[model samples]
Target: MTFTLGPRAISAGYQLAAFDQIGSTNAEALARARDGERGPKWFVTTEQTAGRGRRQRAWVMPRGNLASSILEVMDVSPAVAATLGFAAGLSLESALQKLAVEANMRRAEPLKFALKWPNDVLAERQKLTGILLEAEAVAGNRLAVVVGIGTNVVAAPEGTPTPATSLAALGVHVGAEELFKGLAEAWVEFRGIWDNGRGFAGIRKAWLDRAFGVGEPVAIRTGTATIEGTFDTIDETGCLIVRTAEGKRMPITAGEVYFGTAASLGAT
Candidate 1:
């Protein structure tokens, strides 16, 4: 099946560039932006050869996996642009929920999906999708932000810090084409709620509703040190609020996080 944007996305002035295989959708989107392409456009592929996750980690999308990126040029600070990732999280969460339901029709057991702090979506407590945001300064004080989303439709990487899973592994035999359709439509809904960071409060509330590891013991490893604390909440500015044992609330801007038993082991 051909990959295509949903009706709502098309009506919202969002264009799409679907590829059979690409090195990295995020890289392609940013390159387009650098070439003075101001767009609310999507770059997507099922087979991504080279991709990168947060903190410059390699992200591989094998055949049948999904790799998608959307480009949005806006006049917003990098701080504000960072919050847009919450909308991306919500979009994929909504899309995956629908697919999970359809795949588990006659089964008594239902698959659970949740958003991990920062930029990941979890299914059955394992990482299923990774969202990466990259931005570059453009003319007229506008920032070209590319939100990249990679999902494991048929394959999952082995020996990751956080365990990974796939839709096929969970018996959700859906295609990448179908998943992208749901994602594009769902993005239209949540992106409207985001409103270019103006509506982050609404996004924050909704994200917390589907947040994973909240109120659980977790550890965040930053560049200098590792902080072990209870997973508190995400603040208004999208910072993860971790409450230490001393009852101090520490706001972390970026870090690698581990929850439950993984926290105890100090997985990095």
Candidate 2:
């Protein structure tokens, strides 16, 4: 299918490149950015042969899954640019909500979907979508970030670290192309809310309202060490705030978080 940008996206100077098969959308975006391509462009593919997730985990991309990446040029530090993951996550959640409503899956109860910390969207406590952020150094000390998003529309892999679900499993009959249209539109809205990371306070509040496993027991794995604590709110800097049983609050910047009996190194 041909991927076309919506009117809102086109007005915002967003471009889209769709492929039937590719090594990795994020890799292509980063390569283009390094080669002097400044863009708020999107790279989408049906099959990703060499897709990789956070921490270099292999991402299984079947034919029907949504494998897309957003490349944007930003004049911010890497630390601040990392917050774009929140914006991307929020956009995906909004897009899925629209699809779910259109499919009449959950018209009255829209809270069935929730956002996981750092960059994941959970539907009924199972992973429904994943996001990966990659940044590169550009000229003039600027940075380019590629926000890669994968959603399970028709099928999900089995035996994953965490349980997985798809929109089809939830009775939502939508395709990748249709979903990308909604996603691209939502991206524009959420990016405006983010205001180049300056309006993160509102973004943080919105994310918390839809957060999954907040105030619940959680285990976080940072490298080789594991910390068990209650899931507190995310800090202002986008760190996971965990309150341990020993009355200590730990802010986790990077790690794998597990809720309930989900797998330890779950996909994010």
Candidate 3:
């Protein structure tokens, strides 16, 4: 009754690049690729002066947190490039499980962590990490993309909307080097699913399997429009399929999915 958890340690084909502090990894990766240099993996740190989230929001990246970007060469289309964040989310969850940090688990089940639509990794209903992925067209058939991720490994800063948790806070202690190494290894498997032109079907399945609040009531915030509906499921493109009050099922490709009770939703 034994099983292997970790794959044989192999180079993730990443050349480690570090910075004392930087504005952003996606910026650096795109800049490096444009400058005719190979987009190597960068372990960015030092103040994270201008870290950001999806949609240009300021990301609160305190020192001692996990913030880095992996630049990969791909032949993926623009549409698929848009879904790369899903692949990275899947990779992050797998690595955290290995480190004995269950992001997706309940007291009855085993997986408490879940992925928010578009680009967020949640832990205990709080955000443990977030990702920002950007793809740029290269000269020929190649697309240079940077998958930047930030994890609160040590602690989180104050005044944030959501409560943030770290691996250490979850009772799983490890250093930055080990955490990054295992994460890179998991990304290799994710790259396979992406490179095969499979779109987000595989990633969607993996995410749904461990996702929180699926088939439940949810409230979504879409900036202009706020909707409350039953969380039916996610579509092939990783969009949420929710049932609205008017007996219509809607597709939510972009927006925040939040869980709520049917009683509360009835008031909406």
Candidate whose TM-score is highest: 1
User: Model 2 — which ten-residue stretch has the worst lDDT?
Assistant: 259-268
Q: Which order, best to worst by TM-score?
A: 1, 2, 3
Candidate order, lDDT descending: 1, 2, 3
Please state every model's RMSD to the true fold in angstroms: 1.1, 2.1, 5.2
lDDT of 3 at 28: 81
Q: TM-score for candidate 1, please give it.
A: 0.98
Worst 10 residues of 3 by lDDT: 1-10
By lDDT, the better pick of 1 and 2 is 1
TM-score of each: 0.98, 0.94, 0.84
- Backbone collisions counted per model: 0, 0, 8
Give the Cα lDDT of each candidate.
Answer: 0.93, 0.88, 0.71
lDDT preference between candidates 1 and 3, better one? 1
For residues 113-232, write the lDDT of model 2, one tens digit per residue. Answer: 899998889998888888999998999888999999988888988887678899888888888898999999999999999988899999999999999989988898889899988999
